[model samples]
Target: MWDNIGSPFDYIAEKYDEDFSNSLAGTLQRNRVWHFLKEEIKAQKPLHVLEINCGTGVDAIWMTEHNCEVWATDVSANMITIAKSKLRDNSAVNCHFSICSFNQLEKRFEGRKFDLIFSNFAGLNCVDENEIRKLNTAFFKLLNENGRLTMVLLGKNCLTERFYFALKNEFKNANRRYSVALAKLTKDVLQPTWYYHSLKLTKLFSSFVLIRKRPIGLFIPPSYLNLWLNKHPVITKLATWLEYTIGSLPIFADNGDHIYLSMSKKITAK
Candidate 1:
């Protein structure tokens, strides 16, 4: 399954950072994710974190800077290559990069366990329902007692994307996120992707207790629309403020470009 989708990602690996990771909208959305991460893991000492689908290793680098030991893995070898290059300096020994998919976690880690399992952006959205369920079981086995799982996944309904496209009379594009679809990377390459609601994820990982969930791009526009937003800095600033303010409110939290969820493994009684 991974082999079929590897080409599209490998094609995009070199330009992924330039195209989204460092873009204005990507920076804004990721900053929101980082804020929650800092609040969750900052004071924890000697933290060991495992990041799945860690494209280009941006979040892994940030984790290491905050004194956490990080093992970042991605399915695409080219993506892992770019990530490894960014951390090749001897000083970044705390961070490690490998090529592995979400389904390969158990095989890769074996006896290892982490204090946190983190995945940013919409990496996990590439899989279907079954894969997600398997991931829940794998994550439970891979995490230490009371360990946490933090993910930023594409939401089922993105108000900003819907509104943006609807205004342009692109109805199908507006609603494309509501169901499973093929995301086209090149003329011939298409990757299957799924959008998930917060409730669905909570239920899928029911063994873990949900600790936090919030809207990430509710008011802020998606990365594809950043060019239009860049032309209007003041509006972008106000939208970002709104994003941080009302992002966690009910009805608002799950209606964004992506949803951020944090869940902790439940300790079982002996």
Candidate 2:
């Protein structure tokens, strides 16, 4: 079954609080996201920021609290509505919301260049590399000189790959039960739209200079394992601690599903 035919983002927004925003996995992973963003985000001069596929307002609210004048958007109206409701209490003059698709950013913002352009999680994965490249060009056009472009995406290979493979019944249809569980219980993320190697991504955005290449899920178990890990919170904590100890280490980190890829506009395009 195709994932995009329905309003997937809206479906997610409907359950964002239960599924992610407040769960143990969601709480832990979001800590990683905001911690990393704080270092890169600048709050000077009413800087403009654009969040693509800004699901359910989690990051949008966080940015507002941190002093960024955020112009948040999502393709799904449902998501935008829910996210806006979440922000009703905050009076951040800089925070705004809209509905716009990734391919048509200019329609929503005419001649507005942002100080920062960002997308979180697998939002960039909604389309394949062709879409990523196209968005990169758009990011180039919409950014101020020396602007930063950062995104967190799921890499092609991870423990999730094994899970997806089992669903595909690559090991013969004997694994149908596991596949059915993944399809019904979780987000139906089995149909992969975008997952790429770091080197390939570097080339895809070679126009921009990659400032940092590192892994995010190195020590953390993927979200799908949340249930199993729930029984062993201390052990999970220890395992994640061990994982963090090795986080700075090489190739192993890259193998995880989610990685943070950051870059800066290094050249003036002709």
Candidate 3:
């Protein structure tokens, strides 16, 4: 899916951080993901991490600050350029940025292995279902024994999004992610994207065993609804609290705007 998209991200690279990463909803949503990531990295200590679709290198720089050796990659050269600029003043010798697509992982880093293979915020959604399943083998070859693969993917079902769109009587738009959809990236650009349920993603990486999984934006609402959320700070706080209360419940875990999944590569007896 991403192969044919031809760098649609290039158009948004300059404003991505300002429009989404630094926005209120993005900050709140990312804090949830970082909470889990920090805990996992702290437990591992001195981890070697490979981050895919590392747009703007926000997480990569943070990992370097925590003493992890990080190789951050993105498919878009423009995104990679922006990421490099962000790290230029940091003096983080531990972090490296490169332009490499998900499909190029095997060819680009054939013998490299990492303690953690991480991709955040729907980056993997750019690929088709078959390509995502193929990642099981690619990741298996690149991960050390018992290493972890942690991904944050857009979920197939988001109750809040459905309700929001349904309120506008746009049922088709509400259900757009039920399978594959052509997501509008900009006014004139559309990219093929896929939303996966937790079970479906797990099945794709059958060689790995699930260790942790949770919902993000379960009550927080998707970023597109951020304008309303920003205006209603009290409601946003309540939603955050509600997410804290029920986000991990099995019934709610895969129904959020995005799902967080962490799986460990199974040890195979030689």
TM agreement with the true structure for every prediction? 0.95, 0.83, 0.94
lDDT of 3 by residue, 1-270 (tens): 123334889778888898889888898889888978887788546899999999988999988888688999999888888889887555357899999999999889899989999999999999987898788999999999968999999999899999989999999988988877888879998878988989988898988999889899899888888899999999999998888788757567788989999999877789
Question: Rank by TM-score, descending?
Answer: 1, 3, 2
lDDT (CA) per prediction: 0.88, 0.70, 0.87
lDDT, model 1, position 18: 90
Which residue pairs show backbone clashes in model 1? none
The digit string of per-residue lDDT tens for model 2 on 103-188 reads: 88966676888878878877776676787788778888888886788888776556444565677678543333222122232346
Candidate 1 residue-wise lDDT, 77-129, digit = tens: 88888888888564269999998988789999999999999999999899988
List ranges where model 1 is wrong by over 4 Å: 1-7, 88-91
Steric overlap count per candidate: 0, 0, 0
User: Which 10 consecutive positions of candidate 2 have the poorest summed lDDT?
Assistant: 176-185
